[model samples]
Target: MARVERDPTGDVCPAFEQPEFQAVRDSMKPNPPGEPRSEEEVLRMLRDSWKAGHDKRVEDWNMQVQRDREERERLEREQEQQDEEQAERPEGEGQKIEEDNGKKTKKVYFDENIAVGDTITDRPASYTLNKLKLIEYIELFYFTPDGCRKAQKESRSTASTETWGITQMEGEVVGLQPISALKLSKFVKPDTELSWEEVMLGRHAMIQEMMKLGDEVWPVKVVEAFNTMYAALDAHPMRRQEHGSEATVKYQAHVRREWYDRQARKQGFNIGVINETLLRSMRDEIIDKKKTESLREVSVQGFQKNLYSFRLPNPYPSILSE
Candidate 1:
């Protein structure tokens, strides 16, 4: 191979030259320079070219095949890498596991009266709510530490970044779903000197109202938490009173009176001694009604009239008349 300084170009393989394949034509004379050859002559020239460049053509074909194989291998490696990356990523957590029929569900110590030191657990098991007293309901406090810590962390972030956070606490001011004990007694009205019997009536009225209403709708979490708390409360040692029979007797009397009156009303009669205080209250109510009526009287005229009257201004003679 050689290059001419006058015309710089890549080396053309001499094996592809016509003279190099003259042996294929057995030294046959070529068509005259610039003369158009017939189809047969063109075919003969192509055949001769192929015969001379057989090695060169094979080398070129092999190179192209090698390049294609490398490209395919590179693509396969890339695909494998992508698949490995996908496999490495983890899935989301806290998905509910389907319960097994043969396995007994685990129960945790659920106390609805959530204390500060109590460890709240989000367990991987089903639970129940147990109750002991009619007024004292149990509640669970599972969201305390874990939920509150997360909430606190969120407060830290949001308080630093957002406008609402400016007014909100950067740290938690309270634990998750903290318990607020109710002083609502069925036998005593809250913040009032109402008697236990009066409280019992109010409670009865409330119960009646509750019975008249449809089922309460609570969120799934709320229901579960309540159930857990009740279960613990029911199992607690203090669930049943050890003493106070006198108080119990008094309460039972009130309940029995209510039951008796209810049954008696159904039979078109009245039973049990009505409370003296209650009777006094009814009498006072009647007296108030009579007093209100006594103060009332029929009006002869609903309103005194100030009828609109227009008077012609003082009748005066004009200067022109004078």
Candidate 2:
């Protein structure tokens, strides 16, 4: 008899249709509730699921940390080996050294500890003294002289003729009247006499004081003088005709244009017409003539579609709705 042949599709394997396999497949299907699970059971399931996920994440992170640590250690070992090799090499072989008289003379090094006096020969003592004198003069002018004047009648004594003489001379030198001198004399302490050195130093001090006063007051004087000169020029019979003259007008215009151009160049701006254009733009901005859309409107428009669920309402509902 011929051997019976089994049809592969028609015949099912016993293992494939086993109860264990069927149970596993049924378990994979979502739970169908008869009644909702107890709160304890639901909480226990959630905790188990979370613990499993956390364990898997921790394992992955640990593997990554191990790999990074090994790589870092390998690089550190390589660097250490390189450093050791470099240290073993002879200095003369590694670096070029200049020989002077068959001996190495190291280059001179300077630091803050190296005295300035050591480097500088023949420094003038008088130079330092002069600097000190200048500082003293400024201090006296701002602090001492001002204090003395402010003290007025409170600072007088009879013993020191020198102090009285100096005060009298100071008043006279500065063109104060006799009554003003007497009033000032009440401010001077008679016993508060300066030494001979201080007296001699006073001349230089006075000169420096004058210079400081001149510098401080010169700008105001210049501005006043310029205003007076401008007024005088305006009043002069020649000025109107001169201003009307094409050549004179052209010269003044050219000077002003050149000055503006020079200023623009100094400030790293483009000169000529570009500077004028920029200045005009700046002036328009300062005058509040320029208009721009509200920042809130611009921002809202930019992100209008991208926003998940946000909405903007009219701030003034009547105006916007209308």
Superposed on all Cα atoms, the candidates' RMSDs to the truth, in angstroms, are 32.3, 34.7
Estimate, for each residue in 136-186, the C-alpha lDDT of model 2 and write its tens digit: 111221123433344332323322432321222232453232232233332
Measured against the true structure, the TM-scores of the candidates, in listed sequence, are 0.17, 0.19
Pairs clashing in candidate 1?
A: 112-139, 112-140, 129-227, 129-231, 130-230, 130-231
Q: Quote the lDDT for 112 in model 1.
A: 86
Best by lDDT: 2
Question: lDDT per prediction?
Answer: 0.38, 0.39
1-322: candidate 1 lDDT, tens digit per residue? 2222232123344442356565644434456576555545755666666556765555566666677799999999999997786666665321222235446889888788977666433321011010111212211111223322443454445444433111111234422211111111122222123333343333333333223332442234433433333233234343244322223223333433454355446532222233335434444554576667655532212222222343456567585468
Instruction: Give the runs in model 1 whose Cα sits over 4 Å from its true position.
Output: 1-27, 30-48, 92-322
Model 1 residue 86 CA deviation (Å) reads: 0.6
The alpha-carbon lDDT assigned to residue 233 of candidate 1 equals 28
User: Deviation in angstroms for 119 in model 1?
Assistant: 66
